[model samples]
Target: MQITQKIPPFLERNLGNVLIIAFLAILYIPILLYWYDGWLNKSINIEHEYFSHALIGFPYATYLIFGKNRHQWQKLPNKNHPLGGFLLALGLAFYITGSAELVAISFPIIITGVMLWLKGMPGLRLNGFPLLLILLATPNSIPYLLTPYTLPLQKFIAAMAGFLLQQLRVNSQVDGIYLYVNNIPVEVAPYCAGLKMLFTSLYVSLLLLHWTGKISDRGRVITLLSGALIISTLANIIRNTLLAVFHGNGQHKAFEILHDGWGGDIYSTGMLIVIIGLNWSLDRFEESSMIISDEKDDNFNE
Candidate 1:
C-alpha cells in the first residue's frame, strides 16, 4: 500500500493571520451582544450604525469598479469551504432578532461574506476581516485612532469658516470649537466635523483612480487622498459658514432642523457637488500636462 501526503498552501501558512482573525471573531460576539443591549436600552440609535451601515455600499462599489474585469475577483482553492459554516452559524443568530431592520442590516454582511468566499482578492480579503469584526463588535464601532484626524479637520474647518465670515465683515469669532457670529453661537459639534465628507471624498477619489487608470502609483494615490482630505475639510468649512450665516439671519430653527436630522444627506449632496467640480478641474490639469508631455517628446525626437 502507498501513502499519500497532503499540503496546505501559502495562505494557510499564515497561521498568525488565521489566529488573529479567530481571536477577533471571538471578541465580536461579546461586542455585538453589548451593542444589542444598548440598542434595546435606547443608548444607541440607527445613526450609530453609520460606520457599519456604509458597508453595504462596498459591494456595489466593487461591482462598479471590478465587475467588467472578470479576473479582478480571482478565485482561490477552497475559498467556499468556510462559507457554509459561517452562514449556518450567523443566519441562526440573526433569526432570533426577528426585526426587519436587523435582518435588512445583516443582509449586506451576508452578501459580503458570500462574495469573499467566492473570491479571495487582496482588497476584498482585507475588507472582509474589518466588516466581520464590526458586524460582530457591539455598537458597530469605529476605531478611536480615526478620531484624531477627524477632530483636527473639524476644528480647522471651523476656524477657516469663521475667518471667511470675518473677512466678509459679517462679525464672526472662532472660540475654540465654537463659532460665534452676529450674537449667535454655533458649536462645531462632532457631527459637523467633516469626517463623513472626508471619508466619502477619499472613497470617491479611489473610485476615480480606478476609472481613469491614469494614477495607479502609490505616491499618486497618496497625493490624491491628501487633496481629497484638504478639499473636503475646506468644503465643510464653507458649509458650516453658510449654515452659520443662515442661522444668524433668524434661520436658526430651520438650520437646526436640517443639521440634526438630514444634515449628512445635505452635506453629502454638497460634497458631491464640490467633488465633481474638483474632479473636472483635475481632469483639465491632467490633459494640459499630457499635451505638454507630448510636445516635449516630439521635440526630443526632432
Candidate 2:
C-alpha cells in the first residue's frame, strides 16, 4: 500500500505558498533591523554574545529552511497568521529602549509563536504561541508581564539553598539577597538565580518535543517541563554555591566572568547538555518498553 500525506485545502489552492513568502519577508525584515541595531550598538557580538543571540532566531530560520511545518500557517486568518512577526517587532522595540535582557527573553515567545504557526493547530493557537512564548521567555530574562514572580522565585530558591547548606552543616543564613555563611557574605542576585539556564532548559525541552516525535503532546510538555524545572533548580543551586565560594575567597572574579557572559554560558550550556541527555535516555527507554510490549502482544497471538 502506498501512503499519502494530506495537504491543507489552502495549500492545494496556492494560498499556502503566498502566505509563506509574505511571512518569510515579514520575519526577515525586522530580524535584519534587529541585527543591524545590534551591530550599530554592539549589543550582541561575534565574540561574546554571538551564538547566544544568533540562536534566538533558530526556530523560525529552521522552519523556513526545511519548510517542514509551513502548512500549519494555512489554518490562520491573514491577521493572525503572522503573529510571530508582531511579537518580534514588539520585542525588538523593547530592546531598542535599553531593554536588551527583555529582548532576549522575548525571543522565546517569538520563536514559539513561529513554531506553533508552522505546526498549524486548530482554533487560535496563534494567540497561544505568544502566551507560551511569554511563559518560557519571562523567566529567562526580565519579566514584563508577571514581574512579581521573579522576586518570589529568587527568594524561594535562595531560601532553599540556605536550608540545604545548613543540612550539609556549611553554616549558611539567608539575609535578604545575601547568604551569610560562617560570616562570609554570598550574594544571590538575579543573574546567579540561573535564569538563563532556566530559560535555556525550557527551550531545550521544546526542542526535544519537536525532535523526538515519540511522546504525546501532554506527555511531551509535562515530562520536558518537569525535567526543566528540576534541572533549572539544580543549576541555580550550583550557581549560588559557586557565588558563595568565590565571594568568600575575596575574589570578585566570578562576577566579571559571569558578566562577560562566560560563566552563565558555561552553566546554561552544561544544563542544556544534561537536559538533552536525560530526554534522549528517557526516549530510548520508552522505545525499548514499547518494542517489548509489541513482542509480548505477538507472542500472545502466536
Candidate 3:
C-alpha cells in the first residue's frame, strides 16, 4: 500500500506572505529598540556621500522578490524545521553580545530563521537573493576596515592623476595624496578613495546579475562583481584626474561643476552605464558559448 502525505493548512494556502510578514514584525520590533540610533546615524552619514545610493536596494529587493518571483512564492511549501529555531537563537545571541552594527547584520539570519521555521528550506532557497539584498540596506560600521585602505587608494588616485597631467604636457608632482600641478595643490581626500562608488557599484552589479538571471553560476557572479569594482575604481580615478586638472588650470568654475551638482551626476551616470553594458555583454557571451557547446555535443553524437 502507498501512503500520501497531507499538506499543512498554512502551507496549502499563502506560503510566502504570512512568513514574510511575521519575519518583518520579528525583525522590526527588536531593531527599533536596539539599532535605531545607529541606523539613524548611518543614514545621516551617507546623505553627503555616494553611499546614499545604497538606499535603493531595499525597494529594489522588494520588487525583485514580490514582482519577479510571485510564482515561486506559490510553489513554496510550509514546513516547520528545527534548523530555524537554532538560527533564531544564534541571531539573538549575536545581537545581545554584539554592537548595533551586528544587530543590523543579524537581520538576514533572523529572517532566514523565520522563513525556515514557517516554510522550511525550499522557501529559504527561493527567497535567498532578496534576503541577501537586505544586507545592503543594513547599517554598516566599516571604518576600521576602510581606514587602512583609504590612504593607499588616495595615494594611487593622486599618482594616476599626476601621470595623466604629465601626459598632457603639464608639470605635476605627487606629494602623498596631494598632487601639485603648476604650483597648485589638490588633495585627494578620503572621500575620494572611491569606497562609496565601490559599494554602490557592487550593489548595482548584484541587482543586474539577478535581473539577468545569471546568478546560477557562482564563478560568473564573482567575475562580474570583480569587474564592476575595477570599473568603478577606474572611473573614479578619471573623475578625480579631471577635477584636479581643472583645479590646476585655475578653472574654478569647471572644478565646481564637476566636483558637485550636475557634473557629478553626469559622471555617476556614465559609470553606471558602463557597468551595465559590460555585464550585458558578458551575459551574451556566456549564452553564445553555451549554445556552441550544445551544438558541438550534437555533432559528436552524430
Local distance difference test, each candidate: 0.61, 0.60, 0.77
The deviation in Å at residue 36 for candidate 2 is: 8.9
The residue-by-residue lDDT of candidate 2 on 240-276, one tens digit each, is 7666655655667875665444676676677888888
- On a 0 to 100 scale, what is the lDDT of residue 16 in model 1? 44
TM-scores for candidates 1 onward, in order: 0.61, 0.62, 0.73
Measured with C-alpha atoms, the lDDT of residue 65 in candidate 3 is 69
Question: Could you tally the backbone clashes for each prediction?
Answer: 2, 1, 0
Question: Candidate 3, residues 155-267: lDDT per residue as tens digits?
Answer: 99889888888888887888999988788898998877787778778888888888777878798799989999899889888888888888888999999988865787678
**Model 3's lDDT to the true fold?**
0.77
Candidate 2 — which residues are off by over 4 angstroms? 1-66, 70-145, 164-171, 214-216
Question: What's the lDDT for residue 9 in model 2?
Answer: 84
Can you tell me which runs of candidate 1 are displaced by over 4 Å?
1-59, 62-113, 116-139, 143-154, 257-267
How many clashing residue pairs are found in candidate 3? Answer: 0
Candidate No. with top lDDT: 3
